[model samples]
Target: MSDADTARRALALLDLTDLADVATADGARDLCRRAVSGPVPVAAVCLWPRFVAVARQALGDSPVRIATVVNFPEGDTPIAPAIRETEEALEAGADEIDFVLPWRAVLAGQLTTAGAMIRNVKMRCGDKLLKVILESGEYPDLDKVRVASELAIAAGADFIKTSTGKTARSASIPAARAMLGVIGMTARPIGLKPSGGIRTLADAKSYLALADAMMGPDWATPATFRFGASGLYTALIEEIGGAAPGAPPRGSY
Candidate 1:
């Protein structure tokens, strides 16, 4: 596919879970409702462990998968517990799992611990999709990011995500440039989701553009690219419809 085609495909993989909201499913479904009825249809709804069912019920066979976070905003848990969380999340009806690598372990040079956690979760989840959030803004080095991306992919992460959407900063094209390079090295078609604080349609387009430029035509589309935004879909709808005739009202799912 052409680069432009790839970009369009990448643009479709966005999910707008709340930035700082509780991980419960009701809050997630509320957000999902707003996003789906808006201009851009989110491919998934992400929430906490207790509410994956709520998201599943709310989204109900819309083809928008239910997503849950594991070891969540803080990636500090040990391997066994994280894996246990994965099991509970799956039972709760999660179609995808987003986990953060333990920064402390990585900083202490425990690459083995960081890697093993992801590998174990993947093994337990089986065919379920796993997204390993890099939390790039907190880490001080790109080398660590590179290592995390590589290890996560090798360990079976379906996507190498940029942030948990809880940090002060969100996804950066430059950071994405680096991760995408690593992701591009693999043939299994890993995804890149530059989530957090991307509140405008233009920002979404920018990430899409960067992914197209970095990963070539194969990386375009929801399967290989994703965005985890919260309130950003509201702006996307307004922007998409303002230029056209008869647009729907702005929403808050």
Candidate 2:
């Protein structure tokens, strides 16, 4: 594909994010503005739960969906609190929930606990989309990543996200490949999101290419694929020949 076409496709699949510790209502509004200013509207804006309402009001009736993180960068939040968090975010008009799967629990061989957490939060989410963050960077090997991906998919995650962008390591191509392998095996229509460290058109193209090679060229649509990053918007805007509002606010993805 030409650069313009690639940028346009990537832009449509982006989850323009602002999960920075310093995020504010004004910042959320600004992110929302950027979301619509692009050549094509982004699939969603992923922000902290507190700003779900702010994003909702800012986005108005725009097609850009509002997504908020539950259990967050750290996946240690108890199942009960995670469910409550999902409830409140949905009440605040969040159309999607990007939840942190308890990776540590999975690493410790507590698959049941981790699975239950996903299942419970998904129940709370009801008809809304749920993107489960695996924090794959923390895994010891691709095997572990595959195991976690299987658990999340079986437990009803609408999408399996790669990282939280808060750790020493974030999303990587190898990690994404392993996750996609699992996604391809499933009969369910699960999606893949490779977040963090993806800040340029080249990075976006690489991931898009991988998804196409693994799942087929037509598989990576806004509904089935997403690039979750804040800084990536700038690169896409530059490629598409539009003035970016400004540098995207610093964020943990």
Candidate 3:
């Protein structure tokens, strides 16, 4: 298969409705329904741990996967609590969990400590997919982005995401490239999420391009890439030549 074909397949496997920042159950359901109803086959509805049940219940028998956030934007939680949060979310019907790696842990230069925390959470969840949020937009340099991605992958994340949409800046091509480089060099079959500020088809397509450019054609598929956004898909759908109904704009954190 060609690079474009591989990238297209990867795009199809993505959980495009990553409204993880949606703060309420009703809002989550609305986005979940919007996600499921769209022309694209969204892999999942990503949300806060508090609403995993709401999304799972709302999605019912649909093919969409149910995912929830762990420590969220800050990634400041203690390890024990973070692990507990993962378990709670799993019990609530989350098939995937995205954890924000502790910025303090990474900043204090406790990279291994952060990885170990993620490892424990992965252990607790077993086969459930885990996407570790690097929150690259807040880091001091691209090296931090590189280090964190390696740490998260080493810590056992099934994927390494670029940001928490709660941050002022979200995923960028530089950050995505930094993460993908490490994953490719290691030949680690992990996922990537270029999330946060992505709001239009252009933003999504650019990130998709970054995936192809950075990870090469073969690994750019949906199984390896995701977009974490609040109101991105609606505009993306419209831009992609579809008359898909829109989701209400994100109102709060």
Task: Return whichever of 2 and 3 wins on TM-score.
Answer: 2
Cα-based RMSD of the predictions, in order?
Answer: 4.2, 0.8, 3.1
Compared with the true structure, what per-residue lDDT tens digits does model 3 show for residues 194-238? Answer: 877776656666777777777676666557888776566556555
Candidate 1: clashing pairs of residues: 9-221, 10-221, 16-229, 23-48, 25-51, 31-253, 34-253
Q: TM-score: which candidate is best?
A: 2
Q: What number of clashing residue pairs does each candidate have, in the order they appear?
A: 7, 0, 2
Q: After superposition, which runs of candidate 2 have C-alpha atoms over 4 Å from their true positions?
A: none
**TM-score of model number 1:** 0.86
lDDT of 3: 0.76
Q: How well does candidate 1 match the true structure, expressed as C-alpha RMSD?
A: 4.2
Weakest 10 consecutive residues, lDDT, candidate 1? 244-253
TM-score of 3: 0.89
Question: Which parts of model 3 are misplaced by more than 4 Å?
Answer: 1-22, 251-253
Task: Give lDDT tens digits, candidate 1, residues 1-253.
Answer: 4433333343357675653453444456566576466444667766677777777778776777777788877888877888888998898789999988786677778888788888889998888889999888777778877877887888789998988877786578777888988987898878888887676666777887787677664556767777886565545555454322222122212
What Cα-based lDDT does every candidate model obtain? 0.72, 0.93, 0.76
> What lDDT would candidate 1 get against the real structure?
0.72
